[model samples]
Target: MKKWLTIALFIFSSSVLFAQKSVKMHPVIDTAKAKWGKIKIVNGTAMTSSNDIVENINLSKDYSLLVTAIEDAGLTQTFKSKGPITFFAPTNQAFSKLPAGEMDTLLKPSHKYDLNYLITYHAIAGKLTVKDIQRKINANKGEATFRTIAGVILTAKIDVNRNIILIDENGGESVISNFDIQQSNGIMHIVSSVLVPKTKVL
Candidate 1:
């Protein structure tokens, strides 16, 4: 185990020392860095650009069920694509909040369309950080709408405490628990609940 750790440390150091000059940092990246600093990999399971979004999820113990569902839905390639997408990732506990058997039924092969829809609904085009989301809220006079990759429209607003709240098509709201998990492909914000589309939430 010590030897493995040593090798991983060396590889991590090498990547930082020779990062690609061509890769441009998103404006949000610099902002995130100011707040979160350079992410330090602990046991090869950190949310650094050293790994993409999927890789981070795979490394996370909290997202095991989500990873499996993404694979089963056949939407892995889309998440792996060269993108700067904004993803609202739900934790395992969030999924667990669903009605009994709901998630399992969606993961079945017969429900690929439903599974894909749910997964895609969690993502939006481009890299939208917390600031961007708030800006959209201002532009819309306190509530802004975003079209998910699944073609479902969701609304964003801020509560009294200034917490960004996302309202799904069915009027269900989910809170962003952790914001700005940066990956090579894009950024993800951890949400406390799954935002179901109008069709599913109803």
Candidate 2:
């Protein structure tokens, strides 16, 4: 009788432990995991996503600032459009590299057009993979230029290390930190810095 009682208690304790571990999940974490789906690793460094561009940005760990900027610019629907957009998404650290109070100034309601232009300047129409950009650079004699949706020019080149580097119209340089994050509507390449427009939008 005592042996049966001990076995029952052990089973109950194990079940209780399992239940406790199962309940130790946060809503935000769970939601992010659900939305991101499976992350496919390529070349043991790059990651491909299963969600759309906007959903990937919203669910990403490093794109919260970009998400907020998109919202502030009122370009959420623009990003969600059925497009083959090639977005140079800047990480939070990239946004932090801006001059003091610059992002704050851009985020103001009065500067919505400027913010929109700034964000759109990072996006080019059509889905361009890193290989595509590299081929363009080769075809253009080691430099290629693309016009963004905001009507700004972005130059691309392959560095000595073979990393794709983007030069904005203002001569700001941002290297692609991560490439080929595939989405349903397009692809995103993570950039190391914010690409400022040559002139503020009116």
Q: Each model's TM-score?
A: 0.77, 0.77
Model 2, runs deviating above 4 Å: 1-38, 41-49, 200-202
Instruction: Tell me model 1's lDDT, rounded to 2 decimals.
Output: 0.85
Question: After superposition, which runs of candidate 1 have C-alpha atoms over 4 Å from their true positions?
Answer: 1-37, 40-45, 200-202
- Clashes by residue pair, model 1: none
lDDT of 2: 0.86
TM-score result, candidate 2: 0.77
Root-mean-square deviation per candidate = 12.5, 7.7
The sequence of per-residue lDDT tens digits that candidate 2 reaches over residues 1-202 is 9999999999999999988887785556667658765565422432436667787776656778899899999999888888979999998899999999999999999989989999999999999999999999999999999999998688999899998999988788999988888877788888999998788534
Shift of residue 45 alpha carbon in model 2, Å: 12
Candidate lDDT values, in order: 0.85, 0.86
Q: Alpha carbon lDDT of residue 170, candidate 2?
A: 79
